[model samples]
Every structure is written in C-alpha cells, then in structure tokens.
Target: MLRRVREGLHRWPAVARLVAIAALLLVAAAAHLAARSEPAGRWLPLLVVAVVGALVAGAPRHRWPLPAIWLVATVLAVTRGSAVDPGATAAALGVGAVALVAALTADVVPVLRTRHRRGER
Candidate 1:
C-alpha cells in the first residue's frame, strides 16, 4: 500500500508536488496561528516538518515522511489550544502513537519493499 501510494505520486510533476506540500503546510500553519497564541509552540515539531517536507516533497526522494509530517502537523494544529487535561493527554498520546507509526512506516517500509523486490529478482 505504501509502495503503491509512493509510486503513484512519485511520477508527479515537481510543481504539483510542491503545491500539494505547500498547501498542507499552509493549512497547518493557519490553524496553528489561529489558536490563541501560546508560548509553548514547539519549535522541534516545526523543524521536523521542514526537514521531512524538504526530503519528501522538495527533493522527490521519498514519500512516507510527508504523511508523517501531515499527521504531526494536523494533530498539533487540532490540539494547539488545549490544556494538559486528562482527556487532552490521552488524545495527545494517541496522536503521538499514530505519528510514530507513520514515521516508522515511512522510514522502514520502503527498505523492506526494496529488499523484497531484490530477493524476487
């Protein structure tokens, strides 16, 4: 599934890919900024997003990290204004888990697929 999705987008024109990624990041940034200004806006996540976005979308080198970036940015956008209550904590943990899975899948699945393809050859 991952490979299929990657293969589908892999051939897209670079402008189209950049537009898609920019749209995603712009939406996330708008949401992030719309929330009541908080001093706790984590730079680390934004940094990760920039680096991953560059690697996946800017360079046309990978596809998995883009989804992880989207997941993280979306979750963070949705939860930006919330306090550290129990419910929010639980939700945060869940989002983190999903993002972790996304990142891992993006990084590992391609390697496995390549190895499998090589073995078949």
Candidate 2:
C-alpha cells in the first residue's frame, strides 16, 4: 500500500510538489493564525512562507531545502508566542512533522525509483 502511494507520487512530480506546498502553507497559516495577536508573529510566518515558497519554486530539483525550511519553520512557529500553549504547540509540531515527512517522501521517491531502475537496490 505504502509502496503504491510512493510510486504514484514519484510518477507525478507536479502533484507531489503541489501537495507539499499545500501542506507547508497550511502549517504556516496555522502558525500565523495562532500568533496573530503579536506584531512579530504576524510578519515572521509570512517571511517564512515567502522563503519556503521561493525555495520550492526556484529549486525544484533540490531536496535539502525542504528539510531545512521545515526545521526553521518548526522552531519559529513553536517559539513565537509569548506564552507557549502546550496543546497549540503540539498541534503545530505535529502538522509540521507531517509536512516534513511528505516533503521528504516526495523528494526521495524519484531517487529511489531511479536506483531501482538501475538495479542498484
């Protein structure tokens, strides 16, 4: 089941990229909404979103940027609020983790497929 899904994603790079972008946007939006009361919180998520968007749009061939972006976004989202609510933090982290996994899977699927094609597995 998992292999099928992975293969499907690898078969459709554009769809996988879209899915990852959507997930990242959702995480960024959630973070923004959660901390909208603060001035810094308002712009920070936007900045992160722009950066992530640019990286995704500009370097579709690169895989390292997504993980790095995920790390930075997670840290910023989790630590932005003055008083960190455990529940909210946990939720954000969970969603961010999902986004990370999705991004990594999308990035790795092609490489794995190539290796398999070459009988390198």
Q: Could you tell me every candidate's TM-score relative to the true structure?
A: 0.37, 0.48
- lDDT, candidate 2, equals 0.59
Considering every candidate listed, which one attains the maximal lDDT? 2
Worst lDDT run of 10 residues, candidate 1, spans 30-39
7-50 per-residue lDDT for model 2 (tens digits): 57767778767756764565455454443334556645664664
**CA lDDT of every candidate:** 0.53, 0.59
lDDT of 1 by residue, 3-79 (tens): 55445556786754774567457535533433323333553355455554454444434545544554565467556
User: How much does candidate 2 score in TM-score?
Assistant: 0.48
